[model samples]
Target: MKRWVLTVLFLAVTMSSGLRADSSDQAAAHEIIRAQMQAFQTDDANVAFAFASPELQTKFGSPAVFMDMVKSGYAPVYRPRAVEFRDWVDSPGGPEQQVFVIGPDGRGYIAHYMMERQPDGSWRISGCYLEPLGEESV
Candidate 1:
């Protein structure tokens, strides 16, 4: 029947479009993380701060302050030697991106980045929790 054919066509298009959107989102999220990491490596706090959520930016007041906090509290993230992105998980707050990182001292860390979708539909880093990789896991 023509109706059945049209229904199937609509479903196919919708599913494909959804897939494309998800892939795009994933790419964008990964790019944000990469850019932020690059900024940190270069000591470009302003550039790095741009990738943060609005609330986070407000809380820090300035990029210098944010950078100071990162330097003191997230030393591994501030100077990660090896970085590998993992799965993106959905959370009630928004989405969380898992990143595997190796510090300069060669210790492994699992960084869970909480991402938020901005008003303009772009993603930003809301928060990050770094857990050291245990010997057994490594």
Candidate 2:
């Protein structure tokens, strides 16, 4: 009985400290990505740009410019037909979220999102790179 209680307590403590728990961060990132994608679908450049990190915002200078770049470059992520969140992994820069998406053109893509955690504990998308999946992949 004591061993079982201690085991449960150990797990609770570890999970609470985020030692083995990452759903909160992953879920928040997923929500942010979804909202940004929705904004893109609606052509709301301002709303979509708001989810970008300060670094990207500075690089683009304005939401219009950012939207233009996305429309021309990231077609898959700009208007995906379907999206599924995959793995969240730690990297040298930070945590990365991989999203599997079916593009507007019916092409499969994997979007790697580099997430930046702001000072206020909010996450922003620092960058996204869409890699086309092979014809055999889905």
Residue 35 in candidate 2, Cα distance off native in Å:
0.3
Query: Taking the tens digit of each residue's C-alpha lDDT, what string does model 1 give over 37-107?
Result: 99999999999999999999999999999999998888778998788888777777768888888876688
By TM-score, the best candidate is 2
Model 2 Cα shift for residue 30 (angstroms): 0.5
Candidate 2 has what TM-score? Answer: 0.84
Best by lDDT: 2
- Scored against the true structure, residue 134 in model 2 reaches a CA lDDT of 72
Candidate 2 local Cα displacement, residue 123, angstroms: 0.4
User: For model 1, what is the error of residue 105's alpha carbon versus the real structure, in angstroms, after optimal superposition?
Assistant: 2.7
**Model 1 residue 72 lDDT?**
89
In candidate 2, list every pair of residues with a backbone clash: none
Candidate 2, residues 1-138, lDDT tens digits: the string is 999999999999986667347888999999999999999999999999999999999999999999999999999899888888988888788999999998888989999999999999999999999888975235
